[model samples]
Target chain A: MANLTTKIGNLTLKNPVITASGTFGYGEEYLDFLDINQLGGICVKGTTLHRREGNPYPRMAETPSGMLNAVGLQNKGVDYFINTIYPRLKVFETAFIVNVSGSTLEDYIETAEKINSLSSIPAIELNISCPNVKQGGMAFGVDKDMAAEVVKEVRKVYHKTLIVKLSPNVTDIISIAEAVEHEGADAVSLINTLLGMAIDAETQKPLLSTITGGLSGPCVKPIALRMVWQVAHAVKIPVVGMGGISNARDAIEFFLAGATAIEVGTANFIDPAVSLQVIQGIDDYLQRHHCESIIDIIGALKTA
Target chain B: MKKFIGNLVVSENIPLKNNHFLLKLTQAEPLPLMLPGQFVQLKIDDTPSVFLRRTFSINYVDRLKNEIWLLIQVVGDGTRSLSKNKTGDSLNLIYPLGNSFSMPTATQSRLLLIGGGVGVAPLLFLGAILAEKGFSPSFLIGARNVDGLIELEEFQKFGNVYVTTEDGSAGEIGFVTNHSILKNTFDKIYTCGPTPMMQAVTQFAENKSIDSEVSLENKMACGIGACLCCVTQTHQGNQCVCTDGPVFNTKELVWQI
Candidate 1:
């Protein structure tokens, strides 16, 4: 059997498959769909210091092969999750990562500190690249200076492995990846939803209540793959890639592109069991290729 | 694998006098255990342009034969596409989402059911429950015109049916609150529909100090509270409609309209 176990920075994952933040919510959402403990890990919904109401109506719109959303990091705040959600997640058998977001550098550090105190949550994915919220998230992610500052600040208080998620909306994504890498980030995840929109032609207005939202799904696979390959080569830390990856073929491509781990997004909206399928697909692919360990193919892309 | 258990096609998609339509979904799932005001997310496949599921309150659920009915209006491309689903076609559905209206408990007897526009869906089911329990209920259905009303005849058995239209094309002209039926107080009042209509009912209930519960319609994703899109202000603070409630006590809701 191929060894799927791998390390992201200082942390070790039993497998290379993970569910993207925001898309997977808490692992409980998929309990009826599949056994969450059987997978590598699940990145929970983005959490903050306080509860958020999110955006207004028509916050989501579907594009050509993807869907756009401006959910604005609506969560019950960290205190609620620690008190309410954390205990339940502890028993899931596998270590689960919590995806954290914030409105300011201080806000980011505060959330990281709070999460670090918990025992069950093994790591944190800094979602510095969400395009929907009005404040600190994508703002910090887009600029190399702020991204480094936020990561450095959070790193000081957070003892857990930190996976800084990068945004695709930037002009040069590799530069941002370098900044976070310099700030002591343990790993990096890329290609949060791309900024996109839809319009009601008859009304001559944007279809979404927010006018523009983040796009995800099969349409973004090619661009996301290119960015992941670029970042994987740019940073020494492992890169967790996600975008329009809906199946096993997509996951394997990311692994070959140098991604240490892959997150499955958008496909959760289509079918909740997609993460399980991706895991199974990777297992099947490994058997077919006669690979002994998944590490053998991590970044094994051949150059022409 | 979350296979498509059933693919219901649009059987009859006729525009009601109001912008809403009376849709008959073919290949629909045997109706699940849905109470009134509970809704289903319809994957309207008529157009490739809109892929997000459009949610509709389950107007009726017949579990024995396993069929569900929805009253949808052509509000947008997604909804417009829903109006195009016809007989023999498959429509993907995620059912019985959102919390249902609280059925009348031991303390309540007389139930006042109010509905506006396509909001009457769950109220009918509520009315049916009331009838089965031997409680006589009064129903007030509000629409833009008389033609907007659906399943009115079926409701006659549940209670005294009252209709209100904005253009004066039905039983009573003006808004649903314009009907004299609302003037009378009952043990408990239940409603669903446009914000203005529910707001008016809430106001009337508050003024009368009558305990009333209203089912709100908010745009949602994940319909299971995973996405915090469908939240409403309440005296207790903000609550997700998908989990906390699609149904809320009128007194608890912070009504804008």
Candidate 2:
């Protein structure tokens, strides 16, 4: 009987378990395995104003307990999504949030404006924190000023809920979160993959073609939790927390740390049904604690 | 189209030359239709260090028996652990994943299938399917030595089989590209194996202006396309090897060769 409903600005998610962008492709790849309607929200792959070919061969490398990737936001541009992908996704009952990315401010505005025109897409997660791309990705996220500028311009064209994704590579994640909040961001999501690299000892060469790639998985949980706790305290808007969250227990930690909703990223690669399992686990935990609603536990951390 | 995660009982484990083992797995449910060049991701439950599932090309599929065969080479931690499995032991698999090899057109009758080492796994399935369609495809396989060669008898049942070994103990003394079989005019060629050997085959096919396809084996995490780890550069752009293809026409690939 516990209520899993949560709100981020004007948007109300059925549950707090949203599939992270890039991890879930337009929500079609997993349809055969599980029902897409069960998810609270599906954040489609990162899309740009123009088509992107992505990085070269060996785009990913497996680490100790994680993986590094430099896919560089590969997609067929926003036009194709609107014309082809949007129709297939419009029938889904769950919220469809577009993860918009660009190398320039105009690209962000154009893409966001296009997404705003699509009635089916309820929101857009502005990806200023993608570490794979060479130009605009982490560059805009690492600096508070660039992050604010992109959000401010996109805010003009994008009428839907605007969630700015924060980068962990920054020295002060709170500053970037506050900047986005000030620029009219409805919510903020953190932390996009930590920038890391791996080397093959035998060959003495970098494992990935893009020498340094974004590291994600269970290895990044602790760091992601700490940043979410800090940013959630600094900003008044809802905070969508994610990083190496594999199970429900991991997600509960994020809720307790003050995250309104949670996104499951790398775990999707490990188990496609992980998000559904997490949703079921949350319900079980709330019942076990005799809690009536998820809000009762959100940011309910006990610190001495 | 259906993906299953079930514990398959190992009905037979035949040890082959060069640390290779042919594992025959049987399940209670009916086996799904698996095509040539499609692979299965086997979860390594026994080993702790290897967390990711190991992928193997389907060597054979027997629908009536509800069984399938996996040709595994004990090269890494995952494969080495799989080799230790017994007949009664159970292993989990997510199967019938990735794109399959394209069947040759009716006009393209003369066909050649090439494989190097364990890369020969998918070729057996491809050869069998082609044979069933009334085409006898020639197979040219390469290995390091006589012991390195495997599954010759199963391959012979489909078509003319030729072998090349680094040591001169096999049918031909050099690499598959150097084998006498290459001199024959084949309308279509399919190859999978070491990168160098595949590239060589691709080059030879290009020289003769014949249609050719090559299967690539990239390191993969999810057998599905969710993880973009196993992407290969093609003439069109970068495509997921797990979803877009494990098999692609040589013309589609942008290899340096």
Candidate 3:
């Protein structure tokens, strides 16, 4: 039987299919549909130092074959997650990666420090690249210096696998990925939602209350794959790819493009059972190809 | 984890002229404990091109007869397809999702139920719960016009019902807050509907220093709250409405934010 197990950085996952942050609130929400312990890892919702109230109403707008959202890193701060959610998540057998976000440098360090001390957490995905918010979200991610500086500061506090999540809203995503890697990000995941907008022709107004929102789902797969491939070639660290990955074939594409692990984001909106489907698909593909393990396809793409 | 739980077909698909439909599903299983203000995500395969499930609040549930009712507004392609479902066609459903309205306390003597637009379904269910517990509530329901008002003959058995239509063809012509019944003090207030309408009720309750709980209407994914798709701003911080609430106390909400 083909083995689906894979390792990204210091963490060993049963498979490379990890649920992206914001998409999977925590692992427990999908427990009824599937075993949370069965998959690779669960990246919890973005947590901040102080709880943020998020943005105004009409936070989400549906685009053709995709969705745009401005959820604004809305989370119950790090302390609340550690207090109310972490203990419950400890029961899941898979690795738990905490996705942390903050408006300031100190907030990032403090939140990272808090999660670093937790025994249940295996890694931290610093979400400095969220495109849906007006505050510190894409602000730190768009700039190479700010992105590296944020990663550098968190690197001091977080001893676990530091996976820097990169935003796709920049001019050149590879430069940002290199900057974070230069500052010591063990791994990187791209691309968080892409910046998008929708308009209500009748009202002559923007569909989302935020005017602009982060687009996800099938609409972002091509762009995300391109960035993943670019960053993988540019950086020495492991690259975890995500963006519009709804099916196993999508995951395989990322694997070929050079992502060590894959994350399912907006597809969660399509099917809560999607992650399981992707896992099975990978297994089937591997078996049919006579591959013993997933490592064979990690970066098999040939260069011209 | 999904079994062919049950298939519900369209029994009655009546359009309320308010862009909403009062759909009665015929084929359903024995419902588990469903509370007021809870919802069901429906799989309406009326047409082959349609994809994704449309969510509607459980307007009422008849557990004994094994029937479920939904008050759905034909807003998008999904709902348009649902409206076309014939009586014999089947529909897949995952239901009684999100947090229900807080049940009235035993010592509480009065229950005030507020509803706006399609948000009245759960309130009717709430009224049924109050009736079962022998607590009669005063219900204030709102809509844009007479076309928006849903027939409430069945609800009369559960509570005192009042209707507010923007066009004045019904019980009260003005807004729900303009009704005399809501002007008085009550032990508890429950509401669901348009955000602006709920915000108004919450503001009114705040002025009187009365306790009220509002059910939010936000886009959701995994209706169980995992998607973080249905998030709301609260006094504490950003919280998933699907998890932390679909029901929240009025006073506790940081509405201005």
Winning candidate number (TM-score): 2
Per-residue accuracy of model 2 over A1-304 as CA lDDT, tens digit each:
6899999989999999999998888778887667989999999999999999888878888776788888889899999999999999988999999999999988999999999999988899999999999889888999999999999999999998999999999889999999999999999998899999989999999988999999988899999999999999999999999999999999999999999999998888767778999999999999999998889889999997
User: Model 1 chain A, poorest ten-residue lDDT window?
Assistant: A56-65
Task: Specify the highest-lDDT model's number.
Answer: 2
What is the Cα-based TM-score of model 1? 0.89
**Model 2 misplaced regions, further than 4 Å:** none
- What's the TM-score of each model vs. the native? 0.89, 0.97, 0.88
lDDT of 1 by residue, A1-304 (tens): 5788988867788898888888777978666567888778889999999897777665766677677788888888999999999988887877689889999888899999999999887899999999999887799899999999999999999998999999999999999999999989999999898888889888999977788889888889999999999999998999998889989999999999999999987777666677888888898898998888888888988987
lDDT of each model, Cα atoms only? 0.81, 0.90, 0.82
Could you give the interface RMSD of candidate 2 in angstroms?
A: 1.7
Query: Where's the lowest-lDDT run of ten residues in candidate 3 chain B?
Result: B1-10
DockQ of prediction 2: 0.57
Ten contiguous residues minimizing lDDT sum, candidate 2 chain A: A56-65
Clashes of each: 15, 0, 0
Worst 10 contiguous positions by lDDT, candidate 2 chain B: B44-53
Instruction: Give Cα distance to truth, residue B237, candidate 3, Å.
Output: 4.0
- Assess chain B of each prediction and give its TM-score: 0.87, 0.97, 0.89
